[model samples]
Every structure is written in C-alpha cells, then in structure tokens.
Target: MFRSLWFDGRLRAVLAQVLIACGFAGVVGWLFWNARHNLMQRGIAMGFDFLGEAARFPISEHLLAYQPTDSYGRAFAVGLANTLYISLLVIVVSTVLGFLLALARRSRHPLVAAAATVYLEAIRNTPLVVQLLFWYSVVTLNLPAPRQALEPLPGVFLSVRGLFFPSVSWTGDLVPLAWAAGAAVVLLGARFVYKRRHRAAGARGWPWLALAAGLLLWGAWQGQVGLQSQAPVLRGLNFLGGASFTPEFSALLLGLTLYSAAFSGEIIRSGIAAVPRGQWEAARSLGLRPWTTLRWVVVPQALRIIVPPMTSQYLSIIKNTTLALAVGYPDLSFVITTTINQTGQAIEGIAILMAVYLSISLSVSLFMNLYNRRINRTQRP
Candidate 1:
C-alpha cells in the first residue's frame, strides 16, 4: 500500500501541498515568536489591558455620551461611531454626486461636459488632505459669524460657528414604528425569496416584485404616518436645533464627499464607455428615445463593469475618513492617537486601530462581493 501511494501522482501532489502548508505555518509561528520576544525585551506590554483605563482627554466630535473621565473602551466606542457615521455619510453623498457628475460628463451640452471635466480634474489632481484643509479654512474663515448667520432656508442657519438644520425628533411611542418596520422587513424578505426562486427557475417576476416592494413601503409609511414629530426653530443667539454640525465636521464631510465623488465619476464614465458601440446602434435603430435607450439598455450593461471598482471606492471612502483628524474631526484615528500619547501604549493603540479599519474594509468588501455575485448569477444563462 505504501509503495502504491508513493507511485500515485494524486497522493504525491497531496503530500507536497501538506508539506508546503506545514512550512508556511512554521515560518509564521517563528516570526510571531521573534516579535513577542523582542517586545518583551523592550519592556513594552503588548496586551490590551489599557483599553479599560480612564481617558482624560476630551474628544471634540463624538456621537455617543463620552466624557473625559470615560474609560478608553467607551472612548473607542464613541470614536468608532463617529467614524462609521462619517463614512456612511460620505459613501452616500459621494455616490449620488459621482453619478450626477458622470451624467454631466456625458451631457449633450458642451458647457456641461467641459465644466464636469474641469471639476473632476480639479479634485483628482489635488491631495485629499489639502482639500480637507482648504474646505476647513473656507468654512472657518469665509462664513459669517453666528450673530449674522446666513439663513439659506427658514430655521436652517449656516455660519462660521457651524451649520444648523432641523432633524427628526420622535415625541410619540416608537413601538408602532418598530412594528411597522418589522412587518415591512418580513414582507420584503418573502418577496426577495420568491424572486430568487423564480430567478433560479428562469422565470421573470419584475412587475410582481416591484408591486410587492411598493406595497411594503407604502404600508410601512402609512402605519407610521401619525407618529408625532418635531422640527428645529431659530432662537435668539443660536439655533434651537434638532441637529448641529460643527465647522470641522462640516468641512471634513464636504471635502471627503467632493473628492470621492470625482473619482467615482471617472469610474462611472469608464463603465458606461465600456459598452459596445453596437449596443448603442442597436438601441437607436429600434427607434428608442435617447433616455429610454440609456435606461433600458446602456446603464444595465454598464453596471456589470461598475460594481467591482465601485466597491473599492466605497472602501477607499471609509479609509479616507481617517484624514478627518487634519480637519479637527474626532474620528477613530484621532481618538486612538490621543489614547496612544496618554497611555504610552503605542503598540496596542495601533493594533486596535488596524483591527477596526481592517474589519470595516472586510465588511464593505463582503457586502459588495455578495451583490456582485448576485448580479453575475442573474446574468448567466
């Protein structure tokens, strides 16, 4: 049996793979061991024991209730929330602005296309940190003082102080809204499953799926229509606000959004340009309107090229949120830096920061990969 196994090509290949795996594992183990030994020799504690210590420094911008006396763990959580909020905001705003700019690039008017090209070039050529600083300076220096805040809309004020706008404030019981949301989710989930099954069976249910989604949303909205709401109003000195954005945060958000959008616009234009010329000719020959041809034929195909690169852009947007520190926005990177300086645990602080960022990137990649897979599966005959 041993002689037969040795003579078999499959068995030999398997043995080679096993040996390579063991060698790789040994190398990794040795590297880890050497690092640990060096760290110990330097008397630098590598454990995460400092996460529980009190953070005596103040974070200027945080989502949760965090005091200077809060534990580093709590500070970390606040910083994380701020990071996530800014990231999400940038992703959405950049995506919409990017698509619009992409459309402008393809506009029939020469002025529109030229303007978009100039805008895209302006953003793409400059470093993002410079853009952040520029916006910060503009907002802080150019805007009117709070006493003479510019009221762009009634109850909304913009000034050197910050931007103040109304936000949704719930005054009634939230249980009903929760129930409606739950019902909508169940309805949408079932509809999604039905669509998947039909898709696998090579049957189409576009109208049914649309109707189901519309009904679900409509029902949810109707159920929550009577919920109490509040709106912010302008007060004497400052706005009696629903939500207020500090100058630092506003500038950081604007800079990131505009900068990311330019890159996204280039991705979109490339995706749309990738479609075969024959597809356009075919659509035009069928006597379809320009908009109809684009919506029905061109854009759908372009999405195939757009999704993967767009996913990378989304991850980039999240990673760039770290630059908020330059604009004085207290994102995760800023908090970690302060924590590192105070605690003298540079290693642990950096490790935590790396882990958090790695997790966020992985999460974005995972979601986008799944979406891309669904698109691929549906495209396959």
Candidate 2:
C-alpha cells in the first residue's frame, strides 16, 4: 500500500510539497535561532523603544513642524511623508510624461519619432544616480542666484536654491464649492456607469468636443465662486512666504520621473502595438476620427494589457524613492539609517524599515490585483 501511494503521481506531488515546506521552515527556524544567539552574545538589545527617544538632528523640509527635540517617532513620520510625497509626484508625473513620450514615438513624422527614441535611449541607458547628480550638480548649480532668480510667471521663482511658488491659502467660503465639486464628480461617475450599461442603446451620441467644452465651462464657473491665485514676492536672500522644493528634492523627483518614464513608455508602446492593426482599420471604416477612434476603440482594449505592468512601474517608483538618500534628501531609508548610526540599534532599525517598505509594497500590489481582476472579468465575452 505504501509503495502504491509513493508511485502515484498525486501522492508524489503532495509529498514533494510537504518536504519543501518542512525544509523551508527548518531553515527559517535555524536562522532565527542563530540571530538570537548572536544578539545575546553581543549583549545587544532589540526593541522599538528607541522610537520614542528624542531625535537630536534636523530635517531640512518636512510636512509637519519637527524640532531636534521631537521623538524619533515623529521624525520617522516626517521621513515617511517625504518619501510618499516624492513617490506620489513621481508616479503621476512619470505616467503622464511616459504616455506623451509613447505618443511621440508613435508619431507619423520621423523627426518626432527620432526625438522620442533619443530621449528614451538616453534616459534608460544612464544610471539613475548619475541622472540625479546631473540635475543637482549641473542643472541646479547653473541656475541664477536667488537675487536674479527667474520669475517667468508672477509668484513662481526658479533659482539655484530651488523652485519657490505660491501656496494656496484657503478660506471658509470654499467649503460649499468643495461640496459641489464632490457632487459633480459623483454625477460624472454615474453618467459613466449609465453610458457603459446602455452603450448599445445610446441614440444621443454626445460629441467628445462638446463634452470637453461643457466640462471646461463648468470648471470655469465653479472657479469663479471660490478659487483665487496668490503669487510669490521675492524677499531677502530667499523667498520666505511661498512653498518651496529644495534642490535635492527637485533633482530626485526629475531624475526619477525621467528615468522611470522611459520604461513606462516602452510598456505602454508594446501594449498599444499588441492590439491587432485590423482593430484600428475597423474603427476607421466606422467613420471615427483619429482621436475618437483611439478613445473609444483602442484605449479600452489596450487598458487590459497596460494596467498589469503599470502596477510594477508604480511600485518601482515607490522603491526608487529611497535613492533620495544619494542626493541628501532624507527619505525613510535615510532616516532609518541615521537612526541606526546614532543609536547603534541596527537590527531594530533595519527591521522597522523592512516592515514599512513591505507594507507599502503589499498594499499597492493588493489594490492593483483587485483592479486587474475587475478588468479581466469585464473583458470576458
């Protein structure tokens, strides 16, 4: 009976899986034991109590007011915010820039295509760190001093120090407009749902151009009620009242965006190209203009292909934000490393960093997986 079970393919597969799991568990157990023994021998403690200790160093820019006297917990929060800020900016900007690059590469004109190819190659071939340094060492360095900073538009200044732009000052009156904005968004979403469900029954084909005009008019009308612009005025050696992005941040953001944009463009280009050429021909035969055909026929089909890989790009940008340390921007990694150096709690600090990054990655992956599943179901005939 034992020999019969061993010889059966199903039984063999189950046994193989069990053996592999046991081996993995054993190795992990051994590693944990070894690490604990080593820590005991070295008389080093491992705990997160240091998180509440005072952080005696300063951060250049933080979303919240932080002092050298603030606890490491607060300091870490600052770093986390900074990392998310940069990562979010990079993800949005890179995706937009990448789509434009892909479109440029798909251009019928050879000049436009050639320009895009050169851009893709140049950014992709170079090391990201080098690109970051170039922006910091070369681009920012060559900018005029604060006194002579360029103000091409009122309230926006560009200097070697960095970009200084007007910051929004909100008033109580904007609350009603904010509520209206939410309602408008909900209405638009409902319209999309209605349109999709009755796509075949749509007798009133609202022209895309008219829809665009209506949206613009609505936005303009809304803006008149509560929106206002405040421009920065140059004062002292630096702009005091405006929101600022330090040179290091600007460099890191630009470098990361341009670098990742190359890959994003390639991913999208392949996705778009994978759509059968006959699909485009069919849309054209149905009397659709280029933009209309692309919007209605091409993008919907291309989204299924594009979204899976785009998730990876989004995660990559999140991870790549750690490279901010190279340019003297204190992201989460930078803060954790500094904590380790200051307190000699290497194990604890490293553990915290790993946990935070893992959490971020898993959260992003979960959201993307859900989105991918929804797309797959919708695409099914």
Candidate 3:
C-alpha cells in the first residue's frame, strides 16, 4: 500500500498539497507570534475585552436613539445601522437613475445620447470626495435660511439645512384604496393573459393607464390621500418643524450614488451591447415597437449580464460609505474611530470594524452569487 501510494499520481498530489498547507500555517503562526511579541513589548493591549467598555462619545446619525452612556457594543450597532441606511438609500436611487441614463444612451435623438455621455463622463472622472464636498458646500450650504428657503414648488422647500417636503399621513380607511389598486393590478395581469391567449393587442395600449387613473381617482375621492405639509419654520438661529438632514449624511449619500451610478450605467451599456445585433434585428422584424422590443426582449437578456457586475458596484458603494468619516459623518467607521480614541482600544475597535465590513461584503457576495446562479441556469443553451 505504501508503494502504491508513492506511485499513484493522485496520492502524490494530495501529499504535495498537505505539505504546502503545513508550510503556510507555520509561516503564518511565526509571523503572528512575532507581531504579538512586539505589540506586548510596546505595551499595547491586543485583546478585544475593551469592546464591553462604555463608549463615551455621541454618535450624530444613529438609527436607534443612542446616548454617550451607551456601551461600545451599542455604539457599534448604531454606526452599522447608519452605514446600512445610507447604503440602502443610495443603492435604490442610483440603480433607478443609472437605468434611465443607460436607456437614454441608446436613444435615437443625438442630443439625448450626447447629454447622457457627458453626464456619465462628468460623474465618472470626478473624485467622489471632491464631489461630496462640492455638493455640500456649494449646493446645500449656500442656500438661504429655513425661513427664506427656496421653494421649487408649493410643498417642497430646499435650504442650507435639508429638503422639506409634504409628509404623507394616512388618514381615512386605506383598505379600500389598497383593494382598488390591487384589483387594478390584477386586471392588468388578466389583460396580459387575455392578450397571450387571444394573440391580440390588448385594449389599444391604454387599459392599464386608465385602470391606474381610475383607482387613484377613487382613492383620492374617498379621502384616502391624507397628506399635509409642516413647512420648515425658523426658530431662533436654526430651522425647526420639519425633518432635518445632516450635511454629512447628504454629502456621503450624494457622492456614493453619483460615483456608483456611473459604473452602473457603464455596466448596463455593456450588457446591452452583449446582446447580439441579430437579436435586435430579429426583434425589430417582428413588428414590435422599439420600446416594446426593449422591454420584452433586450432588457431581460441584458439583466443576466448586468446583475453580477452591478452587485460589485453596490458592494463598492457600501464600502465607500466608510469615507463618510472624512466628512464627520457618523457611520460605522466614524463611530469605531471615536470608540478607539476614547477607550484606547485599538485592537478591539479595529476588530469590530473589520468584522462588520467583512460581514457586509460576504452577505453581498452570497446574494450576488445566488442571483448569478439563477440567471446562468435559465440561460438559453
């Protein structure tokens, strides 16, 4: 058996792998030991027990109400939530805007295509931090005081502080409105089914719109649209009575979204390009309108190509949210930094930051991988 093991190619490969892994482990262990020894000699604590200590700093953008008396653990959670909130909002806004920009890039009008190209290039070339500061200082901070706020329209107010819009308050019974909208959606679905069954253009292309309008009108008539505006009121030297947006948060989100959307737009463009010219030609030959062909044929195929790379851009935006610390945004990294300074727990703070980022990256990767697998499985042979 020993002779056979020595002679077998598979056994030899396994033995080689084992030896290499053992060598790597030894090297890593030696390096870690040397580092720990140096840190100890320098009187730096390397353990993570400091994580349980009281964090005596205030977090500015905490999702849950946090006080200076909270523990380091609680501060970490607050920071994590803020990071996630910004990332979530940016992702949604960027994806929608990017898709529209990408579609515009394929427009028949030369002006539209040129404008899209310019926008994409402008966003992509600028440094994200620079853009963030530009928006904050030039756009947001330069606006008039809340009392003298710029009103773009009746219910919307913009100022140096933040945006103030009419907040929706659901009053009357929303059940009827919900039922009406749901029924309209169901009817739209049924129309599609009927079109497929009968092979006819369904109701001259306005049935869905009419259904939506009818439902909206019915809902409004029933007083289901309960919304009121509490305009920003000047209180002493500051604004009051409306939602306040911190400049740091706004800057971080704006920078992240603009930077990420550029890449997302490119990914979409490339995905559209990946669809064969023959597919477009075939689609056009079928008498389908340009919009219809794009909706029914091109986008579905492009999505398979677009989604994976798009996920990477999303992960990048989430990671880039760390840059918020530079602008004093109370994101996870900022909170951790404060915790480190107050507690002198470098190892603990760094460990917590690393763990949080690693978890976020891993979660994103897992979801993207699952989506990629699903797309690959459904791909045409």
Q: Whose lDDT is greatest here? A: 1
62: Cα error in model 1, Å: 2.3
TM-score of 1: 0.84
Residues 316-362, candidate 2, lDDT per residue (tens digit)? 89999888988999898998888889988887888888899899999
TM-score of 2: 0.83
**Could you estimate the TM-score for every candidate?**
0.84, 0.83, 0.79
| CA lDDT, every model vs. true structure | 0.87, 0.85, 0.81
- Number of backbone collisions per candidate, in order? 0, 1, 0
Error (Å) of candidate 1 at residue 90 is: 1.0
What lDDT does model 1 reach?
0.87
Q: In model 1, where is the ten-residue run with the lowest total lDDT?
A: 222-231
Model 3 alpha-carbon miss at residue 61, Å = 1.2
lDDT per residue (tens digit) for residues 1-381 in model 1? 999989999989999999999999999889768877888898877778888888999988787998999999999999999999999999999989999999999999999999999999999999999999999999999999778889899778898889987776544445655665666667667867986877656655576567666765565565554434444565666666577899999999999999999999999989989999999999999999988988999888898899999999999999999998898899899999998888777767888999999999999999999988877676455
Model 3 Cα lDDT, one tens digit per residue, 1-381: 899889999989999999999999999889778867887888776776766777888787777988888888888888899999999999899998888888889888999999999999999998888887787685465878777878898767777776666554456777778877788888888888888789795357586779777987797667556765565666776666656567677777777888888888889988998999988899889998988988999988898899889888989888889888767789898888887787666766787889888999899889988987887785345
Q: Candidate 1, after superposition: displacement of residue 265 in Å?
A: 0.4
- Clashes in model 3: which pairs? none
Model 2 error, position 54 (Å): 1.5
